[model samples]
Target: MPLHSLNHFKSVFIYDIFIQPADQNYLTARFLRVIGMHQDFFWHAQQTLEKLFKAGLVLNGVSVKSKSHELTKLLPIYEETLGSDAFNSFDKPKKLKAELWSDTSVKDFVTKISALGSADARYGLVGYQSSKDDLFKLDQLVFKLRQRTMGLDWVIGEDFRAEENLQHFNGKTYREFIEQNPTEQIRHLSIPYQELKSIGENTQDLFHAWNFEFQRKSSDIDKIAPGAIAPELAFSLSRIDALLQNIEAFDGFDKEFVPEGFKWLLDNVKVSSHWKKMIETYLSESKK
Candidate 1:
């Protein structure tokens, strides 16, 4: 065979066979000769091949139809050149989409991909011609499953028994269940009960402030003298002004401070009033 064809053969074998258990020096000698390298090139080629394999590719049982008899000798050469860290650098897991609940193939792929060094290998497999949508779906499924698992106990909170029941129905359609048990929908989505409760408490606080301002303003206007402004009315107006100032100081409340404030409130604020009680109840029953 021509030198180029021989080089291609070596590349294929390295990626397809040699890395498994092939003879090293012979393969390196052949590879160096095919590339028109000096006698010293064999060691360099061997080292380079080893590095490539270590960077994460393996070909343990790869098929090579044209060279069945030579496989035994080639396999040892490939194995000697294989690197040790052949499966390290990989991506971490991320959240999944809601649609993968029913995909068995996706679930299987996730299981297999997860067995690989990192969740990131899925990204590489995802737009390839052979596994495109299936791989994507698997990635989505893994993310969703992990999210659900992480949020499980916290989301379910005191309702750990109910959470266990929900897990039993993991393969069931979430939409169908929600439709049948509309009341349960909130709980399913409300995992991390403490977080949900914190959100509810924050909302109540805003509502109470608004109501208090309304009532104070009404009382002030009612008690105002025909020709004189009541002191209570003046005080109420001042309080409203201060509250407005506070609100203004928090321009990006919804996005920035609100989430942190909710966490802080949940952790440090005591549940004392009726409003707090109501918020606690709402969170206790929200989805997980």
Candidate 2:
């Protein structure tokens, strides 16, 4: 490969760095939250979400150059780029969407989290009123948005074209190009393929565990809940519903929701092994 081709090839891995910083910010924010440092926690939480937001933009072929850290600005761009239908992957996604975009909950989250991105929040110059409820909402946002940054890779050879003769990666999907190319001989990239592969795989695993394993979605509270309890008869309704939300509503809520619960549900909730293979076959065929 020519010198320019090598440099272009090396530039392909730059997108991978976004996830690293996002993960670092997330870990630190969780640490701060555990120690009851809400201000510092919000500070790091803003950064973590900002990085992931920008990463999603870049991955989807959007320019984030000179973008503001305020999610108010970035979020509209994100919604336009990815669109509202992006939440279709989540269970009871409309509820989640309303929580993020339409409801007063969104106002509280966006304004407060956006304020935390300011220098005042960083230096402890201002005290924020965000509560643990905000933290749980933050966890949900991260879990939902991080999914956008997870799959696929973005590396365009045309953007770095010195000419037509030098094209090592082109006209192929990311995984296909990486697999077939003789990148081992090229010492130009700081990271080898194995390291890049490991990072991509491990990030998804870590992301799922860190964000959701112990966390419960509010929708989980409605697994057996009625559509509406009668408003006319009320005093005992509040206490009864409170008991369900806090205690016996369903499987994946509060103390019942944990990594062990997650694993056990996965292990036990599936159809029997004999039919699982058949289900997998149907799924594969449906995709085809």
Candidate 3:
């Protein structure tokens, strides 16, 4: 049998080309927000949500303007194209307040970030205003879009195995049923909160180290290579006493920046064999 297929448009992610950039932006946005970099946060938040909306549009077979930044325009277009399947929001005026994830508030957010078509509102060039709430509501909208737009089909990789049984019915193959009814396989995508927290702390350290130069603090803005971050776990366990216990319990990988195994560093990582042996011997002394 061929691979199992879910033809529906559901909100899930595995290797979404759209999501990779969005993830980077998401990480950056949260970092900026934590560091009191509110202006840049607005811009990155707008970028993140805009990409998500575009992802929804593209996933649903809807055409998107490649160079549009107007969330007001993009959000509406994405909804209208998806139609009833779009999960569009309507306004509620007489309520006590617009709830956190309400349709009214989401649209309100899209409006606030919509000054993209005609001018660089991100820099306040067009005399428009934005607030921190823009990000809060945008986060809500991101969640909504994930559930409505992502389908389980995304998780199906090239190495995915097909089902043994093909249940054909209703004048349609199994793929047809799944494609039409995406909610059957609904899911959502997310990132680790702890990682975002670390990025913020590291960014602050880098900022202070370089005298708070927002621009050109390093060669690449996205790929920040800060020397140190807070809450160093390797040292957090009072290792002077627990050193031997921690060694045996080690994860067999360096957790400083991100997880990487000693084996890979031994083979593919660039370094002289002499240095590698020196470090290996140094670590071996811990066993004594």
Candidate 4:
């Protein structure tokens, strides 16, 4: 089978496995056990073979048996593409620079970003100060363009003091600390609870029709509660707000100070409705 045919299920399974870590070798065994093959070694083997074929791995023109080696091979590609370490070490910085420079005429970059098969793949730096530099670059580009147009002293002021405070607040660089521990990074990236709640309330109003089920009945108490908002929905919206705030702060100086790269970043900021729906479904199902 062509790799493209396997795209949908492969991505879904890989994401579940990555976010909810399980022993790869034991996956076949656990699956077999669930299907009532715990005591039947032969049945276990057969089922494993079937799974391997379904997963698109073949050997000698036959579906390969699920062995440790074959399973390990699938592991690295996913880790490289979807893992936090992979994003922090390789993809994020490159993406940040690319998006900043892409500006308005960055369709290719947008398409590439859209191809990323992860929920958290939209912006390079979510809540960190490193992202500010890209914003600064955009501001400079916008300022320069305005200067050329108006022929005036239109210089954007640099926020060096704020940048320095972010840099030296702790003993180490923010990226270094974030890379060292992702959970901590998430905590550091999080907005205040009140702010997140306010956003949820605001989004609930903007998407009022979408909240119909939650508002329909007084007996549907659980549905109307603040916790009823899907966790991923809340998180994603908060992230978007954070990115917007960063953009606004950077653009506060003047429209002319907008970085040439801001267009690229905006172009690549799309998150598909299908993916968002999937996240919402996952949250609802998990809550149940």
Candidate 5:
């Protein structure tokens, strides 16, 4: 019900729901570029990251300028609000972890992604193209930010389900709080419970699509050679397999809701031989 809680919720939802999916779409486009799909990656990524950066600023109580897309410029605002120590504590993407943390590297990373927001990248104002490395860094940076914002509502003692004051934190109470606040930002944060529910449901849908649809449809897959597919897709499949393994061990969500392929993937993961076998089968079948 508090402002911090609202900010945390907005930041997390924007990053996890909107931004994360856009990032995955960007990644998927890299391997499955057909027409304007690559542009989808660039534009959506720039827009999402810009909003995410602004949300981060709002979360930290830093003033956000209206409609800014230059994420590198926001770094100073973050530093001023949260302090350099807090910013430094952030765990960057794993690939960049070994490198010594520097303001320059951070700025460079942000700037490169921000450049995608330029008219050239968005509308082909001039000759411009995004590289694979650029896309990869954008993916990693967004992932880290998404993870950072994930449990913030709980941290701020604003989780409606966990907080003792259920009546005060309920929808009616939150609506009343927004009315009292009378800020454009507060007014805009009127998130329906169903909308929140749909975010989780949509993620479940993605899992189902990947497991049942993408993996099930033999023609949907592209075989690079006799027994190998694109490395990006294989890595993604392995990651999904690992995700299912973790879920099975952790037992957080309803196992009944998990698709059959997720279970099968985990079983295959245990066998270790199944990955190679499946690829071989795919290749042989494709030949046929």
Candidate 6:
């Protein structure tokens, strides 16, 4: 099945774009409010929950209701139908009712958030605009939802079986295939890429580490002489070069912000001791 049509993928994507940013300290509460997209955070979060609940039902072969805004209503029905154990299947939202004024359950906390988006935010109600303090709490809550939703699709045994089959075909999972193939990976990883943009210095290290892991998993490296180019190093260098080339082609990037070292490093790929010394020195300097 195409990834977009999957309910779990849909929910995760919404959470990634809308809720993930809420956790970044760089995005201040005041900035979020003035940015005019605070309401979207709530709206997208609610939609994410709605899709998650529906996916759980559909995967279990239960008929989902046509459309429902009341998450409190949906929760009881889904729990009753699937049994409480299903809640245990994913990373369940942590219990924090004692922290709330009205002694709300974790389930109740989710329902209130759902209401914020489905009714209040959508209609521009007076209380729809969350206060700065409220945004902080909301951000924490959304962060939990985003993390918990990650493992939700694996609740059913069928997804595991299908994944095994997928791995068998190409020795890679659906996600692995997408990661190795960046055009499609961009559709998903863009959110994370944007979030991490604040940390400029480590950008190349992050790419190198991530690409090295992928290459390690899917490619074999043969041992060679000490000064000879190791297959792994050669492959990783090419991957890093490809990434830097793409970054350079990005329109309107300040030339100063683009790592000049990356281009220089790409131009000087070699297996000599001097090349290794250069890399070690460059890495040490990067840390400083």
Each model's lDDT:
0.31, 0.51, 0.49, 0.29, 0.44, 0.42
Give the Å error, residue 26, model 5: 5.7
How do all the candidates rank in terms of lDDT, highest first? 2, 3, 5, 6, 1, 4
lDDT of candidate 3 over 148-236, digit per residue (tens): 44432333332132232223323343234345654452332455444343234566445544343555554334554344533345343
Per-candidate TM-score against the hidden true structure: 0.17, 0.44, 0.48, 0.21, 0.40, 0.36
lDDT of 1: 0.31
Pick out the ten consecutive residues of candidate 3 with the lowest summed lDDT: 1-10
Q: On a 0 to 1 TM-score scale, where does candidate 6 land against the true structure?
A: 0.36
Per-candidate total of colliding backbone pairs: 21, 0, 8, 10, 0, 0
Per-residue lDDT for 78-154 in model 2, tens only? 77776652332222234344444323355457667889857798898887776535656666676655655522343
Q: Where is the poorest 10-residue window by lDDT in model 1?
A: 146-155
Report model 4's TM-score to 2 decimal places.
Answer: 0.21
Residue 113's lDDT within candidate 4 is: 20
Where is model 4 poorest over a 10-residue stretch in terms of lDDT? Answer: 147-156
Q: Which candidate achieves the best TM-score against the true structure?
A: 3
Local accuracy of candidate 5 as per-residue lDDT tens digits, 1-288: 221333333443344434455445444444333333566566656665665555555544444534255766766665565443223333344566444333335566667656756667768664446553554555556544433332222332343232443345354433343334322122122221222322223443433332434463433233222222123344323433343345446333333423433333233223246754653454454446
Which ranges of candidate 1 are over 4 A from the true structure?
1-107, 115-130, 150-288
Candidates 2 and 3, the one with greater lDDT: 2
Models, CA RMSD each: 30.4, 23.6, 15.4, 23.3, 20.3, 21.5
lDDT of 3: 0.49
Q: Name the regions of candidate 6 deviating beyond 4 angstroms.
A: 1-37, 65-67, 88-103, 129-192, 195-288
Runs with alpha carbons beyond 4 Å of true place in candidate 2: 1-15, 87-104, 150-288
Residue 232, model 6: Cα distance from true site in angstroms = 33
Residue-level lDDT tens digits of model 4 in 83-173:
3422212122344555444333222221222223112322332221122232233223222211111101111111111133234334343
Q: For model 2, give the 10-residue run with minimal summed lDDT.
A: 184-193
Better of 3 and 4 by lDDT: 3
User: How far in Å is the alpha carbon of 59 misplaced in model 5?
Assistant: 1.8
lDDT of 5 at 90: 30
